[model samples]
Target: MAALRAACYVPRVFTPDAVLIERGAEETPMARRCRERLPDVPFTVVEDRQAARVAIGDDFAAAKRRLVLAEHRGSFLGHCPAGTRGLRCCNYLMMNFATNCPMDCGYCFLQEYLAENLPLTAYVNPGAALAEVARVLDKHGDRRFRIGTGELADSLALDPLTDLSADIVPFFAARSNALLELKTKTDAIDGLVALDPKDRVVVSWSLAPEAAVALAERGTTPIAARLAAARRVAAAGYKVGIHFDPMIEHAGWEEGYRDLVATLAAALPAARVAWVSMGALRFSSGLRRAVRARFPGSPLLTGEQVRSADGKWRDFQPLRVAMYRLVRRYVEEALPDVPLFLCMETPEVWQRVFGAAPLGEQALGARLAAR
Candidate 1:
């Protein structure tokens, strides 16, 4: 399969009246071009250089670097329960990064959520954010905590360009209690292949049916490739997870999900899976217009959806229960030992399907820790 195409371009340039670079320091392909083209301006590289070359000509590389203006005020760590919408997610730590994503799924919330359409943005100050995270960790040393960057973007999509995972993985590994989850849809596992593969970090993927991917998702690695990556991670001794989030209720839904679960069971030992989450398709009313405008042909966006108590449009109770039950049965049949949890689902649905509400995050953490 062809890899997802990327577009490289600097989103902005900055001159902050601080941190001036010497003339000789700007010698690389990125820096030299920046100096000759925009002399006196401070800049940083942001988007995909290779994709930019294909889309905007080779000169796009020399275009000025994009710089995001940001500050680290207090605590860097952020938190969210499974129930919060991405918009309601108040955990904005130092953004130290900009938007960059090549995949264009029809249901992507980023299209409606972000101010700009740019899918890839590089924050030039991850080191500063790391320092802030350390400070917050030290200050709250007594408390057990969790934090992740996958909410706004795929955690490791630009890892090949930025080398962020290589740097961040070791840092999190050193902190015994804190956990980091790197969630993505791509099969870019090479960068993480050499890591210690301990339970401190979890590698998660958003999975869907092949029919759904062909119909709605674009520029994403196939389910087979993603499952293969998960198996590889498990072989390396890492705790792996799969999320059937936004699970679309399409034709042959039973067969589609059964095949997916069978594939996972065959690829890796079910006992190695840390956790599996199943969530039905849920969207905000605000995103309805955006979906119609951007992807009119997508059937997944045109379903009989109604607003839930949480102010998001979701499938009705019966349909949702059927989907969840089907998935739970297949997964349990394959890997009865692994914990299967529901994401953002209410207690009623939990009781009907799994016979219990999800335990608190602390208890879940303890259960996984014991494993």
Candidate 2:
């Protein structure tokens, strides 16, 4: 790990000059690890976690980019894909190990979900939360629980300093009824690769074309580097997954995605892959203004988008179906047997794209668990 960090010149945004710790959380392993990363930084122990909001001040968007660490004193587990109703949900559980990404993509919902100017926080006590998860799993050992640690944060963005994956991977490896899916955009797989192989753990990546990544998803690993890391992990006996989520309708989008599918197919081991997911670029109507405000020249906002029945903005149904079909065709050619599912889309759209839909959320959950 030392040699890997020395060789990689990745600029870390989670390094804070001053860290605010919730009084009781100051002595945890996560906090100690954080303090070690910024050795000379000042530590302010606060009685309440919300009291640190003063440091956030008036401009939250601006403060979010700065290096400020906060110890979260809340539960780390959260409800994911299940919260959005009337759709084919995978019943995925969100492990809120961390919050607020260091990499600021233009379309991130963190802008709305997190308090403005809240420093990037890592919940130190996921052990307590995992105990609760264990209780639930203990009762339903026959059922599969697909939990992920990337809904609110890129699972590996702060891994070099925190070494969170080191603990997380092994914990999931011991569990038979659950799978820990570490979804990330960065190629921070060094710590992950060093660990023993865990068949129950899925290291997944959020992918886009090189062009779209540069335009919207900033401060992420290059597409080529990501695939290289995926290949390395697959060779190490881990089931890799890919997410073509937020599939942007950028210029030359069709050609770009087609080439991306070909690249992934040629480079990745299809048999070791768990599954692939697709979701078109969709957000709340209010988020359009925020996205525009954050990225003034971003072309993503200029593309065709409409408010669907779900009261969120998305490309027209036909255009979205067309994009999915094009990408699916290319991807299926490469990963012939891999399960290709949609994220947060209606059953009608599912039937249109895949010719069928899951009977219910539980049914979809069981299907993904089998994978």
TM-score, every prediction: 0.77, 0.90
lDDT, candidate 2, at 126: 65
Off by over 4 Å in 1: 1-76, 81-100, 116-119, 365-371
Top candidate when judged by lDDT against the true structure: 2
The lDDT of model 2 is 0.77
lDDT (C-alpha, whole model) for all candidates: 0.63, 0.77
lDDT of 2 by residue, 1-371 (tens): 33332333235334544667777877788778878877877777876656766665645455544343444455667778534757668888888777777677788877666745456776777677677678878998888999998987889888876788788788888888898888988878888888875598889999998778867776666788889989988887788989999999877889999999889988887888899999988878667777777678667778778887677788889999999998889888888989888998888998999887755778777777777
For model 1, how does the per-residue alpha-carbon lDDT over 215-297 read when each residue is reduced to its tens digit? 66666677777888888877876778788987888888789999988988898887778778788787777677777776776
In model 1, state the lDDT of residue 206. 87
